[model samples]
Target: MRLFVTLNFLPCSVFPSPSFPYTTQEEESGVIANHLTKHFSSSCYLSTFLLLIMSQRTLLIPLSSFFIAHLLISGAVSTTFTLTNKCGYTVWPGILSNADAPALSTTGFALQKGESKTITAPASWGGRLWGRTYCSQDSTGKFSCLTGDCGSGKLECSGTGAAPPATLAEFKLDGYGGMDYFDVSLVDGYNLPLLVVPQGGSGQNCTSTGCVVDLNDACPSELKVTSTGGESVACKSACEAFRSPQYCCNGAYGTPDTCKPSSYSEIFKNACPRAYSYAYDDKTSTFTCASADYQITFCPGPNTSQKASQETNSENTDTNTNTPLINSTMVYEGALSQNGASPSLYGSVLGSHVTAAIVSFTVAIWQWRQLF
Candidate 1:
């Protein structure tokens, strides 16, 4: 291409300049134009090189093995987190208890060293940036990953051959009008892996206003998001009491120890800053959790951290002022005069004090209502 272009330009410069002396300036200008075109074309490609610098690329073959190894280990860690937090077990409401727990043990599947099985990934892990779990060695120098990559429903979970077989579970709540959106609190990273392939609403970009976007982003106030579509997300409210370095899954206070963010922090802040609630869900136009369970109980959450501190202080004051009076038997005797005796001053004035105390007690309790 260069040769041809040079050939055309040279002839114009040579032939026209030599044979037609009057055309010398025109040929010179033509030569400059040709040079300028080539220069601009080269400059235009600078962006391509800039892209190469901005995007990372390496000896990928060597790193592929490393990435798979990380996935194997991360996958095991993921499974551990999944069961304890992401994985759901039935709970006794109001009174906190895991009465309805998963079976203690089961012999279903295990991955051995150098062994591999094809496995289907969770709803997340469906984008160009995210990598799928591969059929590789398991962590702990023991077993391998799924026989094939994660996509098909073939592989089994591994645990470095030291851990027991993993148990998977899903947690979800129904929405008002029965329309459902996956809970951000239940999934691993709010099932962020969904963004990779088939899980990410199938490559659909969720925005602030579009219906397609609302399918995932439209959380209102009256309806909060805790669990969703068989995945674990953030739901700390029902679980957290007051703030003490508690970790939240997505929006709700999560299982006591894990903290996973669903998307960019700012994006999450913009959509949900105060809490993950039913009213916060813009879909139904409410700002709270869908289930009464989200509200009826006084669950602790991010907000509760500060609120708890205030409650503790108030409780201490109440204990100092009111508990002694209630504990005093002297007051009880004043209420029940001895052997039908005539009303005494102790009974008359003290009885009036008790009634006044009850009224004051009710109002004091109200001062602490926000803690709930």
Candidate 2:
């Protein structure tokens, strides 16, 4: 009798409509339920039904708990990134997702002055984005850029990361403790002013962060990357410029304690405090947020050009004092409001989810014994 009942009811509730689509977390759950129904045979249903019947009323509790736990683990929220070009010149943006993350829609695209493009990413995605400057196609239809080039020889970088000497905006969405980690890094180098502003997110460290000052004009002569026309195109990091283990933070200097910031890194740090100047500069440079979209802008400030010139002029004068290279308060006032919750909150939230899963599994096991 128990076997008969198990076989009859298993097909009824376990399988769902095969037509169900999956995109968001809720839809994905529905699809999973549907898939289970379609694949399981009547005998399988009977076995499940017999177990449930023998387990009595308590069996439903664990089964339901298992489904809920599954949903919590599998469901994910997507993130959107809007790329805007506020520069006076064109910027070709390049994207490279991490090896484990899903690929984005486009790896590279052109953004003319005052243009914007939006890209959507699936949950738990991680990648870096950067701008390419002075790009042009040769007579042979080969594409290339002077700075931040991915060397793909085409518009799309595909899976290639940006070449060194380029400012980078890196992101890991839905990361540790259900929080998103983001930062603008100049550790590779600096080619242009970049800003990352989180939207619709909350976290104590969640705010706008980037190297907004144009460092090319005021870049140290030894570290400056110049174009063929004698234009300062980008700034190279101490590591890239010298390749010393002390500067690269490798070999004997691999540890954080040994890898101290150099004079060249200090120049970038003084100019852009929120951006990563060296490999170990994480405490001040990294930021976290929860449930947020992001806006990435090239040349963000209104008086960017004038400010660049002013920064260049003031660089030599403020060599002794601790004054930052640019007035961040004036440049970041309206759009760069810094406010949010701490990362610990996200950790607690994740802990609760994990606890719930463990409890659900335990309850199911105990109930199974009672039923048997």
Candidate 3:
């Protein structure tokens, strides 16, 4: 005997055509037919078919849930960053991922002289990156940095912000209106000059935004961070030097109307026209790029030849020094839509198709057993 089964689990609206007909055939001419004829009664066939169906249903329920959850989670995308060090000295890079997000490769790591590192960030990722100078690890394994220290007493920042007088590269990837917003902010002060350039992207005024000028050279006397050798290692912000309401932009000067740019902030604005001068300097400071990779170059001034020479010398003398000037490129997947409707609809249709497939396979198995 032969058996034919048809599965009809999905609605007409889900299919491309008005209806989808799935059929399966079973024949009593296989090895299972001979075994059943010789060993089992007709009542056994019914029980066997029911048991098989139950087992299949149990397996498919979890599979369906897993598939659905996978689709929902896979919608998020990644963004790439190429962080380079152009200074003659080694810089320990520190990264702080956005709130509630996970940390990347390292919260902080050593980038040897003329070295670079690449990092990938998840969708809607926001964070800040800064360079820590004059860092050392003690015999007890506790680490400390001289400038741009996060106060963690360790190489890794562990969710801490850089101390004042640290140049900062801030980013918000795949953000509002389907664009990535980034800036090289000196609001915390400046230890080094960095440039943030967007590559392979398109948007209005999507040019590079940075403060390449060495603020440490022109840093005010009261705000200078000098080393033991009396060399200025970093530059402090006006707010750091004077904690008054005018410099800090607090109290009566908290609002944008009252907090006009002072002579101090104007200095930074004049140097880096695309960076935030004060708390309310967003009009010209904020920049947007759509689906772009960013390059953050520390100490990106007129030291190209110096950096190259140092890199070559370091490579020849220090065989263990493996960090190169350029890190590998990273590709972030996923495109975030303005509204949530597109992904939701896609998940729904995909789930329905998977459910239909399970139904067809189950029906086919059941029909094949019936023939025996």
Candidate 3 local lDDT, residue 83: 86
Which segments of model 2 are wrong by more than 4 Å?
1-51, 54-76, 305-324, 327-372
Worst 10 residues of 1 by lDDT: 41-50
- Give the Cα error of residue 358 in candidate 2, in Å: 14
Comparing candidate 1 with candidate 2, which one achieves the higher TM-score?
2
Over the stretch 1-372, how does candidate 2's per-residue lDDT look in tens digits? 132122111222233323311121111122211111222222111213224544233234334645554345433358999999987667899998876677899999998778999999987778789999888899999998889889899999988877889898988776655567788888788998888888877666777788877788778999989877676778999888887878877667766777888999998988888888887776788777777889998988654432111123332232212323654453442233444334454464555455544655555566556744
Best candidate, lDDT-wise? 2
Candidate lDDT (C-alpha), each: 0.19, 0.68, 0.59
Cα error, residue 220 of model 2, in Å, equals: 0.4
Candidate 3 clashing pairs, residues 3+ apart or interchain:
none
TM-score of each candidate structure, all chains considered together: 0.18, 0.71, 0.63
Better of 1 and 2 by lDDT: 2
The model with the greatest TM-score is 2
| Best-to-worst lDDT order | 2, 3, 1
Encode model 1's per-residue lDDT on 1-372: one tens digit a residue: 011100000111111111101111111122211111111111000000001111243211222332333233221211111110010111110010011212212212332212322322221111101111122233544423221122222232211110101000111112111111222211111111111001111001111110001111222222223322321122123112122222223233232224433233223334332212211222221121111111111111111111101112322221111111111121110122245443332343244334434433343344224324
Which RMSD values do the candidates have, in order? 33.8, 13.0, 19.3
